[model samples]
Target chain A: MSTNTTTRRLTMAQAISEATAQEMARDPRVFVMGEDVGKYGGIFSATTGLLDQFGPERVMDTPISETGFMGAALGAAAEGLRPISELMFVDFFGVCFDQIYNHIAKNHYMSGGACRYPLVITTGIGGGYNDAAQHSQCLYSIFAHVPGLKVVVPSNAYDAKGLMTTAIRDDNPVVFLYHKGIMGLSWMSYFEGSTNEVPEEQYTIPFGQARVVREGSDVTIVTLSQMVQKSVLAADRLAAEGISAEVLDLRTLVPLDRAAVLKSVQRTGRLLVADEDYLSFGLSGEIAALVAENLDTLRLKAPVRRLAVPDVPIPFSRPLEQFAIPQVDNIVASVRGLMTFKLD
Target chain B: MEATAEQLRWMYEKMIEIRDYEETMSRVYLEAKLPPKIQKGLAFDIGAGPVPGEMHLAAGQEPVAVGVCAHLRRDDTVVGAHRPHHFAIAKDVDLNAMTAEMFGKATGLGRGKGGHMHLFDPAVKFSCSGIVGAGAPQACGAALAAKKLGTDAVAIAFFGEGAANQGAFHEALNLAALWRLPVVFVVEDNKYGISVEKSASTAIASNADRAVAYGMPGVLVERNDALAVFTAAGEAVARARRGDGPTLIEVKTDRYFGHFQGDPETYRPKGEAKELRQHDPIPALGAVLRARGLLDDAADAALRARVSGRVQAAYDFGRNSPYPEPQDALLHVFAE
Candidate 1:
């Protein structure tokens, strides 16, 4: 049934840049503004070749002031302009948090529906290379925790394009967190399909929808962003061990697709949450708590296990950072533990 | 620009209307603070009225709102500070809806979600923030839109002297000047931010002095005189319309009431608030009109009565408006 669908191979960076370009072409009100987004073609190349196509007006390069530019985006959104603001890194949310949290997130609510904030704050997240603590961290949950902002983290190039389109079209503020490791940059090594087959046509993947990447019955591994790739690798190892593992990719964290998760858990009877964010009070904990609340209905065979970064800043050293972040080996271990659980 | 008799009278009427509305808000807020009856074990009866939460009254500072907003059109925007009642009124935001919002009524601007501190009127392009200096950058955005859209519409940002110290404020000024956005940053120097005096907080004697660093005109107006404020705002608005970037105008104003209703105000000298009231711009505006022969004793009395009646009607509208269901809070957080 899917054989007729036409697609082309593209990297996650290409998919995102194409999505933004298409949106900007379609809507004059939609424009891209951020540090190094114009002449620099974006440091991650997510905005490469956009400046020449769209010109300096549409593809803007802001000063090194996140708060100033982000706040300007909020105002422009409020004034009926669709602004796609790029915060260079997710870790830099600290300086401009007031604009994002207090203003951008609350404008629609605080204005009593009088205002519609059509804003997309796209930022790079996750750490694989030695970018150190500041540059490498996936804090999607921090944005998801706040109300009024829709949080989306795409697993592959196909999902990246679709989700970016949806985020641009969304009237309320949407936080588009793309993992740097999954961008398929020449400088970075990523798994297959990190740059996958994507359709050229503009399309949208609705927020709060989860995709079952690899379906299985023995266990369900829930993860998102680059971790989706890692979880799939772990599932592969579990499959080799004669244990079926289902990998669920949560495309968006806020407006989370809890139904898809519960359905997977119901079938698998065991669940393992792998998150790249901080373990305590984060995506993993939230998922575990969610499943725990539905234990009676879902009828899990055992308690949900979580593999995430320990409660510490990402380390500078490669060994410490690797140990701190969740890895495929850790996911395999957690899934193995889940398979060995015996109900009393 | 010299103020004509008609224009002076109009400014006086706006100032008086704001004064009356703020005074009414103060009375209603004080009533909300009353203890509950013995039948209820609650210290304060939540059911007594729809009005709840803090009230930041802009009483003596009516001249700032009146003057700045007079230069703004419906399409032009104004982003205000926490003390936004006067600005909302002067910008011609629907008084009935604003009052209803203060009462937490369903008909309020935010459908009873945002109270006085966060009133938003899209028709007038008016919005305020509870956070200090948060509105400055936003105002620049609006001005950017106008500039991009090739419209002469300018944006005004209303903040306090204390907000001048905020990083957002400096960043906004720098950005506006850099981009040459049509925004006028109006700092209403009400002398106090909550309890912290401007002297203790800000190092600069005048917030306007910092405008030179951003390469924009800076002016200090006699805040108590509506004519003086109006003249200063006129020049800034013109400069912005002429694509001359932003201007910083510091209006040396005063707030007759505490930062919020029910504040003990122990930080102030015993008679400071009362003494400041002697320089209240509402009456000063009326005197200005009288001096110009635009208003007589009978006309002044008639204007005050009409303003009081309108304010009273707004209060009645608020009292009659329905409070939103608890579930309504969950709505409007996302777009439909």
Candidate 2:
């Protein structure tokens, strides 16, 4: 798969739709099915033009039963149909969790490996939409804990397309989290036409490598999803103060790039984990703990700082939501906080 | 009735095996050593005898399974919910495997990893799914597969009235109708989902009413009377086999216990359960057979004893079976 070098521009949503379309085109059995996925072309338009292209049988529009359609996707896969089921909101995962965990995850092992239930379950995660209680949530950690399930969390348009393609092609069941906020994010170089454009041909990017979005040696800021953008802004602010900060964008959560994180920490001798979810059990907390517990090679550093929302649900009000999520200012304050942290 | 008297006897024996095995499971988990949840949900972990856990026993639901399974061939598949003992028995899965699964042993169905809520037995073409209203679509998938393979083997999905509210029910019924995919949708209205009564849980009094939305035939049956359920299921199954499309069969029955073991159910009106007890299917059928001169006390007693012995054996096998190994636990994520 070659990267597009032209000046053609597209949003993250467009990239994802392109990847899905290419995969479905490559495999006749690969079909798209979900609520409003056909005629409506998905709630966020991620499935645009598929219904007309593939017709109603393949690009199916399903009733509002995540559990049923989700299970059907796996069962169909077992019967030799490559299916991609969509969950409109990742927060609504509880209703159809059985099909995902029980039916899809355990089918092969239960039958003694006589089957391959390949499925790409895509769902929209994260909040900046003011969708309130049930609509907005980042539950990757809950899914990340499950065995036999691969999780992909992309921070940019290019990675979003490539990682999703990889998830679709995976032999095991995979969950791809599409951040709502990043769908419309402006990529300065690619989508903005200021830099190279994505190629039109079929391609996919590998998972687990953390992209060093902005390089600096004074301190390292590790984050993922939309938080990566916020970390970049924080780094820019730190640069103005001559406190250079390195920012790492964790494209995937499950096969986490620990080596990159450790190296960055060792180089900078200081670390700050900026996360979208609650601070206590988030990926950041786990990363910081791993570094502190085993960072004997990085002895010249200060205690790792973490910039995560306290343990609380995402509130509805704008201010409350801001307080519940890590913002650019929060990252800046956190980077400043780590300048004098002492573990000893 | 084209089948011989021996086939009928075998069907009855399978049903009885499920019943007696469930009783054995209850005894072991309760008075013997297991918990009620483990005992009740054992139907899934083991071969599909009396269905277990969180959902009520299909003790009274066995005849539905027997009568329906009586029609399906080996390639034909069936999907069931939490209380799915009857379907497992109908499919003829290994009793020992079902029991071992219930105990979370390696030898069990799904290597004890599936637990009771997620039972799978490819042998009998029965897969016990725990998701409420989840199995219907999978049944549709199986039917779609059979159709694609040009096989007349119809897939039947047995669920509850509570699941009729689920999105899968609507999606599947519509698909089955649109494609004539050879599927039968049986809704066992067991009267409750946990404490939510069917009358309270569903906007429509009967799930059969929802079938109108799919532009298909939806019928209500008396679950307490096995003959009625048999007759309804027969027509529906036949219609699906003939490629006429899908049928929604809602069997109205009383669950007879709290939603689960130790539920201390206090929702029903006083004596409502007592009033429903007189309509129990087993005795009702027994009375019918006696009046028709088709049953003798000696034969009936012999059948019960035989069923009890077999169930006892299954219980012994599951109880003595070794637990799953810790390292081997990771095996089989993907089938080869």
Candidate 3:
């Protein structure tokens, strides 16, 4: 929004690293720690060049002890230090989730406002590059299901930088999740528009703000993270076919942009949610329920449709993996199907 | 590390206070469990008493608390496991507030949100968790904060021997040592983790033995002897304050009650808990005081009466306190 700011095309990983670097330089309390974050520069390149700039004390390389480091981060946060802890992959939350859900998330409420836990847990998510069930996952829904945590998933470099900066500054515990497929790493395949022009100066994007990527009126495609790219492609294709489809990228899951979602649904009268998480009792269901709760009030058109991974582990095989993931084809088909749905 | 006559008397009085408080809680909880058809004047109902929910009484583990807390400062932090009443009282948390919390009153430490297991009294830097092996790592964080803020405040984590097997426990020990954080990890080896003996669960003979793996001193003390525990914990607390990192102290004690109130406890040998009461630290320490000429029968009787009166006042305040409105449950879920 600032015309005076300089812009550069940075990858999602670079944007995240720069955001963390700027925040660290700006606030003395902010520090980064995780497995291989210091010397190795992070496996997904999220913390590249941070150690050299901030030194070893501020940018720490922890042991392969998830529960230890995660709990330590929460402990440090409660003591008035802003700790940005990386959990490597969102799939590894199981090893140290007790600290995240019970301690870190519940500290403020449990203390009766006497203690503040300013912590950010940044982790990589999404399945691609043949990472099996263990590594590839988009479990933002799980963290969002928790009450105390703020969940954010960035679809592009610009939003990634902005949201990461905001998460670092926020007082509450935040779960900053990134899709491995959209990090713009050269070794792994990435979507075409994953990397985008990001402002060089530090900026903050407030949570609960939904970005309307492409505006249309026939059907609104609600999605986030890696699925945002596929939704955009699906909307483009739908537009070429004379169908106006709107694409809404939910940047943060916890403080959901309910107004944006309801407004889009009211204008389109058709809803299609594309998610990478599980289909049953998950984000998709929550969105459908949100629409269902307001169906009697909103202008009626069609039942809400959801496109998500079936309830199963992500297979190692590429064919099976792609089949389980919500691809552009699936989004396109789901949107087209909803366009033809008839209301009773 | 020697306790003077004053310190000994203070420890004895504190231990008596804890004993009286826990005994009264047990009595009130059982009275609530009685069938309503008994038609007693007591307004006790099943699961609807002033002090409702799970109550883990620490009637026999007074030495461990009295020993460790005797060395701690108000600025220091202490985290406890499921059975935390002894730690809270030992750390000098407000008894009236703690009682109100146990009674689910708004004036409680956690404002009634956290019953006994999740009590959080930031005023004393005290917190407890029902989760096994969860407090050690948090204690490390508190120590780290103390170090970073240039304060000599140390942290103490009180856990059961059973929680020593948890990964969080191992991680906490390793992290505390690797960074040389000021923390004292105290394992109250009550010999039973909710009806399972320490031998039946953990492979290690003593939870303190695991401290060697983390390059720290491990001390095992006589759990029933308050003076022995006091001496050992004093050294550990001194070592931590001297920037010597953490020390694992295993206090071998016994639980006079079930893991939780009303627990069937069929897993333990019959009469073991009742039999273990003979070694209870309160009477043991009182005997020591008597031998030292620090306390006579009249002095002991007067101390017991005073402690009993204080505990009764706390219980009356809790019983007279009002339960939070149903909607208050949704409050305190997030801080504004």
Candidate 4:
């Protein structure tokens, strides 16, 4: 932590672009390519100011050809160049998942280590600004489920910079998912806690380490990305009600920090997985299974609870979308419900 | 660029090898799939053979593979679509490993993770995907890699006519042209995308013409002739290697079998495949070789015997090879 008095608080978007700019300036092998990642400065502002800094060759604006550009990224990575290709939205993965999963993800393993794809696919995730079913999704769980690709979802500006640096430096293909709401975009309402005092120096955050955002003893909220922001708010409000809630942000899903999750739940004795991704067969179930499989050493105060988007598309209506996606109040209420159960 | 006698002889031998391999696979794929081998009342089962699961054979499309691959070098990359054995064999991929991969053996390419459609042999720089139109973009990527790495090695993507209509095909063409990549897109017009005729699926008559929209030259081989494909591919490969950018070549080819091993193919007109087989490119290429004094009866018999030996040995190796351990399925998910 930088204790300088002149510390500047940066948005998640600025921190991401800063990290990319630093890495690009340091490593000539690193470059950026995507639709509007150059002139438009990224739809979520993740690549803002990169085009002017690095010029056109390093910061490329691609045609609206996801498969072509994504495959080109894979090829470039295989040839020993590090490419940061941006998918405008995570929802659009369906159009080019063949290049993503079958090639970029599996090429290293399929080639028996003859080839390595060191690339970062950065895509905007989550729903809040009525981007409907097609545009609104936090499908990092889907990417995590597939083998060979690392999945990183950062909750705040500081973690975004560190994790994006790590993802770029990684020798494997990584999907760096940033929540649109947490990027501090002007058009959408955001959680203020997502803006943080990030250090200007380049740093790398190793994957599979969970951050204990707020220490609590009552119940633990296992979450990630935008839900981490909401969990912090829920934990703050729960303090007023004398219901302490520990918030654990799972920074990366592929190399998931099971020990951090189990240790937190061991002390709190209760678990509530708050996620913005879908409800079924997803992160919530995996977290619950992690706890359930370790019942010999752990005692549970209640059955594990989950707060996630119900198995429906993110609705266009505001109330319906909020109802489907887990919010701060939903996390607070879930914690309150967990407090009701007694071990005896 | 014209193919010399050596190139013509090599193309003829490879076409014969591919034809023999596909015919053998078609027969082997049906060994235990009939009514008696499966449960009662079922006429046929696709998943009950020695080579289980869906099998797509390229019996009548050997000319397309041999013609394109004849101009390729060991360093060049070839990306093939679903019906990929012809491309794999023509690209000099290990016959034993590829066959064993189809049989799901541990010694196979990809260690049996990828089957016939998804063979990835990095040694020969040959790979294929089961997804239609997926290979085009990947081929472009390989070409881009060569260009960036300062190599004259070109790449070729072999796809069916149906893939030409896919968004990936158009996108790859545009990207290849925009970047001036050293790639050649070869469309094997087998006339059907699993029963839907090209007339019904494609709006345009020839997919080669679609190349103009992406600012590339389009060449169409009006017949299923190996020499015609060789000449077109040689020119395209030379153009790509000389940094002339990408080209699109469409070969009017034939498919003598159903889409898959067990496909009823009731959608086809009666005797269409039989009628198409009368102009089989394998014998036609042999006739050309014979006319050019490149082949005699004794030489042709000797070549057939040699090709048959190799194909039979590959099939035997695949059949006799051991299946991978059950727990091995969890391996190769990631590189260490």
Q: Chain B, TM-score, each prediction? A: 0.95, 0.88, 0.95, 0.99
DockQ of each: 0.80, 0.34, 0.58, 0.44
- lDDT-better candidate, 2 vs 4: 4
Candidate 1, B1-336: lDDT as tens digits: 987666777788998898888887777776744665423465544345556777789888888888877777899999998999889999999999999998889988888888888999998899999999999999989998898788999999999998999999999999999999999999999889899998999898899899999898999985567888999999999999999889999999888898887777999999998999877776677766677778888988888899899989988988899888989888898988
lDDT score, residue B314, model 3?
90
Best by DockQ: 1
User: Residue B273 in model 1: shift from native, Å?
Assistant: 1.9
Candidate 3 residue pairs in backbone clash: none
Give lDDT tens digits, candidate 3, residues A60-179.
888888998888887778777899999999999999999999988886776555667888999999896778899988889999998789999999999999999999998999999999
Q: What's the C-alpha lDDT at position B64 in model 3? A: 90
TM-score of model number 4: 0.93
lDDT of 3 at B239: 90
Writing each residue's lDDT as its tens digit, candidate 2 over A307-330 gives 876778888998888778878898
Prediction-by-prediction clash tally: 1, 14, 0, 0
lDDT of 4 by residue, A180-208 (tens): 99999888889989999989888899999
Tens-place lDDT per residue, model 2, B58-79, is 6666667776777788778888
Residues B1-336 of candidate 3 have per-residue lDDT tens digits of: 888898799889999998888989998777546567435774434475556778899998888999999998898989998999889999998899889888888777777777888878778888888899999998988888787778889999999999999999999999999989999999999888887888889997888889899999999995577898999999999999988899999999878888988787899889998889867778888888899999998998998899899899998987788887878767755545
lDDT of 4: 0.90
> In model 1, which runs have C-alpha deviations exceeding 4 angstroms?
A1-6, B35-50
